[model samples]
Target chain A: MIHFFNDIARTRLTRWVFGWLFLVLLYQWSANLMISQLESPVLLRVDLDLTYWLVHLTGIGEFFRSSYFAAFSFDFFLTVLCLVAVLFPKRTIVPILTGLFFLIYCVLLNSYQCWHYHNLITLILLIVPFCFRSLKTFSILFAGLRYAVAYIYASAAIWKLVRGSVFNEGQMKWLIQHNYVDRLAVEGYELNFLENMMFQLSNYSTLSSIALIIGVAMEASFLIAFFTRKFDRHLIIIGVVFHLITAVLVDVSFLQLWILFLVFLPPDRITSSPTTWFQRQKA
Target chain B: MNFFLRDVWKQSKIVFAFFVAFILGTIWCTFSKIEITPFFLWAHYSDKQTPTGKFERIYIKVNGEILDLPKFSRATREMIQLPTEYFVQLERTDYNTNTRQLIQKKFASMMSQKSLQKMEGHLCNSKEDKNAYLYWMAKYIERVTGKRVLTLEVGTCELLFKPDGTVARENFIFVAKFSRA
Candidate 1:
């Protein structure tokens, strides 16, 4: 059964779903998060990023923290150039992909206290590197960070679900309403149109409930995506669009950070086709 | 002093030296938490006066990339959590270019259309009708920024700095635009 599992439907679906995410999403994610952090109370307010304050104050920051980001950026920049130089070889691309995710994890642990979505993506990014045999350094870092992101994603999603927040239609409405109304389009700010959509939609609680259900689906799908790249790819787009909708409408700005993992894996590959795989298994 | 040095040596000395460097880097140098806080202040007050100049985020496409740079928000700083600072498209053309024609035009158009869109509304609500709209944005920003025209290739959001560099524009989203080198 396991041997027969590999098929075009699964592969193609997976490829279609995840392609843009795994290739194009990582840089934006890190850029979004790092930029956001740079503008945070911890960094901008106190004049210290996580590396400067957290890691340095605690332990790792002493040597690897301060110039780490700068060096890492330079390193990443070089790796990318090399990839371009080599005409995007999988060998070169994969290693760099793996390393970038590992770096994301280090940055997150250093900066924020909570294991937020930022941490989760950082973790997810390291998976491919772990799978590569010859690249031990990349593998080790990937394994550690992947575990971190997976753990954080699961824990947080569960927490939000349990609190009646993630699934609550009323809360979702509040989020929508809070984001919409006169405050939303206030003087032509961002998300003005999204605010308009939410406002128009929120008048009916039933529609509001559907929006809530969409949220649940999105959160639930996020978990599934982690295990399977197809779902991950599809959901990353949904997640980003949703966040973009919200960010514009409500002022949340972590779209790239939240969906960073779409960068690795065959985003368009599917594990199986619902009908064909099922029929074959049945036969 | 000898005893202290010896203690330092006992702990991973390599680790300890690195630690000191980290501390000095954080403590000695300074950075700023920049958002559109000042921009908001400007917009809110200007809204009270000029009626059309309130802080805002406008979406535009450079070449073909869709962009959104939210420069407005309603929440006060203390009431918010997480990094609201956005990772947006960067600006190119050497700081303030005196001769970037396309850029200046795009900027002006954005400044104007920002009014037509909501405070940070959908990035590209109507894609097909945007050529004239975009050209106008570049035209206006160029008009406002300077005289000479410059060919440009950078994606950046407007940043409003406080005199002291504390809060940036709050309650808004940063845009995303792929930069081409």
Candidate 2:
């Protein structure tokens, strides 16, 4: 961070963070205009949505039309502005002016939800070019982030294999038992042979008992993949594959964000052409 | 120098606190009360209705022949009202304050079997005809060899007859559930 104040990161951090923030903001604003219901059931995953409401609650209810639109925009827009103040680095996480704007937006919006994937990832990408300036803090912070990502993956895998999910009779059966989707897909209500076979096999005491063993193995391996040196590539490849299948069948977008975390590691994590888990694990 | 306000965003605490507050407040507003409206619609399956009375047979004139038959039926007719409970049949063995009328009516109707004259019949399809027929049956008697109908205000059931007091026809016991105007 100290080095960032000097010539080390003055130009890089400012350009990177601000550019990403502005570009994303531009896209979101335009998209929001076209689809009017973007805010109702909350079509987008926005953490600072409360700002939209404070515009209605306080006396300045018509804030969107006049009183507070600029102020509201500045809440996030100024976070981007902090990249400019990064040059000063006067014992400030971000500069004072940017901070004041954030404060006003926070008070008005009352936004409490902490940073989710969108904010965190975008912020990281914006700051990465500057991170090289402080190798020690940069390495340690990146390591911690890497561990956090691994934890998220392990938790997800654990949650899935719990009594109701992949390891047990509950979720698989819940999926097969529902007739509505099958009916829609096939023009009539009938469980496919593959699904039925899975159901019957799952119900057997022998199969259910084995599933618990397999589940523990998968979850443990997914967690260990990040820490272990010997089988890191093998384990990570398997974890990524499992994640892809989960994304397709269960439709959880947050987990897709998780796949990005694995990319944070040194290129040696997989030793291949930098992508595609489908190919054999080389590194 | 406006140190605190100017430098507040530098404090993870203020940012943290504000961020937390903002998230929670937004959730609270999102979860606020939603209005629910009440609704009503018409229903199905109505019941039969009649009035109340207790009377016995004074004479026995069957098939236009005078006979010394005392096996009589004293029927009761209770008027139709909203939300009736149940139809009751009682004998001396089971008679109580509430059921005494049913018991007495049962015995009197049994012992006072006298004259019965069949009138014009009713079709089963129409609801109006069913109520009218049940009401009219309370006024007169009909012994069509196979069926004996005993109906009044509360409910309708049938009694079968043999010379020695045995049921000869299938008895239909109907407890009407609802009555629509």
Candidate 3:
């Protein structure tokens, strides 16, 4: 087992990963997605998830929801842990603890919001490879994570294919109408350019169908990563474009999941000097 | 495949085991329609959608002023909209009694009666749940908008796309009001 602390390259890459993860956390905090900002929510939506039910039954959920002090304290502790992990990326325990706390945060936030916010799944899982300090172990786990991200997109495309929704001409039109009709209908409310374009597209079935097919094709392209790493850069571009289109048209922001794209960056490139990073990308 | 089985197993048995377990668990969850977090089905937007002639819209009025949800940030907007929509949906279904019954009937052979009852208790909504949700929602609104919510009204209305490329509100399903003391 190669010690990551002794390897400057792996250490630098780990720090780079943690730095971006911290920035994502800071953005989430600013967006009021943090527990302190949520205050102490009284209601917990357990849904059908057995793990959630266990949390509710064990009084752990109640402990967080019933006391703002407890919730805020946990949030502060989690932030501190994440900061420590970012600073000392060589410490194996810090990332492990941060990952565990982040899991609890994801579950609690979803319970409070009464919705299963799955976009955070990428962020949560991406923290796992950093928990290992063994260079070989970290590399293998990181490779697994890369495959997992590709699987997410590829499986989504497969689902659409299996469910026969890919062939439905009205699918995209209905989705746009369902998402934007209320906003467009609100009198005196100004519609932005993207919203206007989406509304116009909703009225035209052919245009919307073409957009949906393009989306499916983009998702399907992730399958290429499983076969070869040569097209990883192209996959990253497609992933970003896909998420951007969804954000603009459906108002769903999966930008946080973009952190997973870091996996596509070769470890050597990540470990390279920061000033040369842009130059390397251009090359 | 040979490299994975030989080298990965030799280097780290734990990582090898974890990969195997996660792959199997994800496959099972995907096929069984169960999501045990981290092992999601990833079947989002997979089902076909068709126009129902009307779109149901949730409207929230805080301190007698209706909220333009599109004006807020995505996170804030979801924080406000998701719970309100869920609450209204539960109200329509009588706090999920219908859902509970269906679950009980479907899983009768799979789960014990006591376990099913406990699940029902956790899943079902009550008047107290509604009150708690309202209180938390009011506080969240206050925190986000920096306005003390004196009165909050949540309602749902149907929106119809007219022939002339315009949308009109058809009729309100219901409206619930609450006041913070």
RMSD of every candidate to native, in Å, equals 18.3, 28.5, 3.4
Q: What is the TM-score of each candidate against the true structure?
A: 0.38, 0.34, 0.89
Which prediction has the highest lDDT against the true structure? 3
Which candidate, 2 or 3, has the higher lDDT? 3
Q: Determine which window of 10 residues in candidate 1 chain A has minimal summed lDDT.
A: A39-48
lDDT, candidate 2, at B134:
36
Task: Kindly provide the TM-score of model 2 when superposed on the true structure, using C-alpha atoms.
Answer: 0.34
Query: Using DockQ as the measure, what is the rank order of every candidate, best first?
Result: 3, 1, 2
Structural RMSD, model 1: 18.3
lDDT of 3 by residue, A1-283 (tens): 2122236766766676677767767877888888778867654566666656555566665677667788788878787786787678789998898888788888878877788778774577788877777777787887778788999899999999999898897898888887777676778766778678777888788888999999999999998877677788888889998998988777765877887887776656666677798886799
- Model 2 segments more than 4 A misplaced: A1-68, A71-133, A160-166, A175-217, A225-227, A255-259, A262-264, A267-283, B1-181
iRMSD, per candidate, in listed order? 19.3, 29.7, 3.2
Model 3 chain A, poorest ten-residue lDDT window? A1-10
Compared with the true structure, what per-residue lDDT tens digits does model 3 show for residues B1-181? 3344455687779888998898898998888887777787788888988876588788888898777787778787888898898888777776755446656778778999898777665555666677777777888888888889998888997889888767788677655788967
Return the candidate ranking by lDDT, descending: 3, 1, 2
Better of 1 and 2 by TM-score: 1
Among the numbered candidates, top TM-score falls to 3
Q: Rank the candidates by TM-score, best first.
A: 3, 1, 2
The top-ranked prediction according to DockQ is: 3
Candidate 1 per-residue C-alpha lDDT over A1-283 given as tens digits, one digit per residue, 9 for 90 to 100: 0111123432332233234334433543333333222222121111113322232333332223245465356445533542342343334444455445444434443333211233223333423433343333332333223223433334444545555555454555455544442233334444445455665565566776676566545545555533544353465466667666656544665543553443333312234446855787699
